[model samples]
Target: MTDSPEEPNPYTAGLEHKPQRDDTFYYTTVVFLVEGTLFRVPRHPFIDGSDVFRQMFQLPVPDGVEADGCSDGRPLRLEFIQQNDFKQLLKVLFPHHSQPQKSSPKTFAEWRSVLKLSSMWEFESVKKLAVDHIGTMQIDPIDKIGLARDYDVQEWLVPALNELAKRKEPIGMKDADKLGMELALKVAAVRESVMSSYSGYPLQIGERQAGHIDFTNAIETMLTTLENS
Candidate 1:
């Protein structure tokens, strides 16, 4: 009779990625150990294991999966859990991405940071998330005059420009008139398109422009507003 390779408890294996109770909501690394046979498991489910255990073990193990796990006694599973987490984070950050105009900010600024990081890394889904969030706003002076100038969120550009001449003047615009005017024209075009697509009247431009705004500035402002005195 041939002896079957040991099927170690996935929960006990060094390759197993169970999340600690204290780290369930945050990112946590897990280790698993299997003496002979190997298998892949997901991250979040392992973190909060409930009914998923049965489903994972039921799936047939693919060839070469064992070889990959047993190499040099240091198993590195290819489940790509980080990528999955990032993808889920994108959904949380930009829920209304396709609609553009109706999306609201997620409850936490962590979502915004995730979107920004995703954009910086050129992650397609992450970029889409940021764009969707930007599209919903009325384009405050800071976004129109500062962050827009650097980050290039194309969706907000045209609406901002359309109302530029009438909107409250941003500080130190005297030196950047040409570039400002150029952006204003682009914003006008974008605004027209947005208004045509939506049923509501266009948003009004405000007179008081925010000063010295950046991504961090926006985040700080939001945090302050959230923590009312």
Candidate 2:
């Protein structure tokens, strides 16, 4: 007698996707593997927040090829990404994203993680949120310069460098180390030139300008020179 035929498994090891888990209209989750960690979270947040993810999810799977993010055995791999950063991103997307602005308990470092990932993924809204949250922070000028450059925060460049050049507290060894040799040197040069130009008779500069030493033009010139060089 002929033996009975076996039923096909819909979960994995298939050439084509056959709707295994979370195939509903609204409730779907994508599995991601990031630096040896596994995260299974809501798929909609990614689709809504990032065009990259939306485009990826929209790509049609070719015949005879397996799709990723299907189950625990197979997950979408996030290369060159820190698991910690992914965790921080998930903290906001999972259930806390709908809450009020700046409501999450994330620290500065965690927000930075969000910034890094969001920037990389082209999550414009999420990136803006990270930037806004960091705006309220009390980071120092030197550190702000570094953060500004790292994150493409153009709004922070002028204020941070101006503070660095105008502040009475001389740039110390620790400050130099923080700003790096080249930037520290530029800041020192600007301060010295400004001090020399207005020695003895201080310029009124302006009423609202107050005690400021007028580092705007000098900083801009220095920045131009730095850029050209």
Candidate 3:
């Protein structure tokens, strides 16, 4: 009889067995726990848009190590972020064409959440988008100043502060609280000086509205003086 074929090498045989494909697509799935709810989102947007997520994914996975839900075919869990905030961020990062109306956040609160989360996560593009939306919105001047300062949108600062300075009434306690005492005092003083100087006489329709022009000029002058001084 022909010599029995050499016993198949058991280790090599095991190595030769190819594992069945689980899925055709090679996308990573991440799970987030937000306010007791679980969010299963694709990892691509996070990896591409956020430096925080990029570095997290780059960490080495130890042999045989398993994460909850991950072993049971669920995404790996990410915790600590608020659900509403994460949802708002997802709306910006992965807008769906089917819901064109909801593709981008329209309200100030939603964009504020987006800005907060995107900024925290270092999602530069999403942060920029949030900033753009917030800049164009009809937010209260004092609130706009706060947002501009928080987001480093310097272009919004002077215009928002100028609007506050031009208001006929004194800045309210609530608004002053938001603006803080020093800036609030400066605005109050500028408004007082502008009204006293600009309101003594009425002008023709052809002439510049003195209150408007003078207040605008005075605000600019005050800001310039402050900068120079």
> Which candidate achieves the best TM-score against the true structure?
2
Q: Per-residue error at 14 for model 1, in Å?
A: 23
Q: Name the lDDT value of residue 74 in candidate 3.
A: 51
Candidate 3 lands at a TM-score of 0.70
lDDT of 2 by residue, 1-229 (tens): 9989978866665657665464456577789999888888878889989989999999999897767887778899999999888877777666455355544536889888988888888888888888899888987888778888887888888878987776766667888887877878887777765643255665442222324465878888888888899
lDDT of 1 by residue, 1-229 (tens): 9999987776767854754565445533323333333333333443233233234434676776653333435554434334433433434443554255424445324344545545544455555765676556554544454545455565554344434433444434552454555444433333232211113543322323322212233333433553563
Using Cα atoms with residue i matched to residue i, what is each candidate's TM-score against the true structure?
0.32, 0.73, 0.70
lDDT of candidate 3? 0.73
Looking at candidate 3, the ten consecutive residues that score lowest on lDDT are: 202-211
For residues 111-163, write the lDDT of model 3, one tens digit per residue.
99998888888999999889888888888888888987787767888888877
Poorest lDDT segment (10 consecutive residues) of candidate 1: 190-199
Q: Please report, in order, the local distance difference test score of every candidate based on alpha carbons.
A: 0.43, 0.78, 0.73
Candidate that beats the other on TM-score, 2 or 3, i.e. the better one: 2
Supply every candidate's count of residue pairs whose N, Cα or C atoms clash at under 3 angstroms. 12, 0, 0
lDDT of 1: 0.43
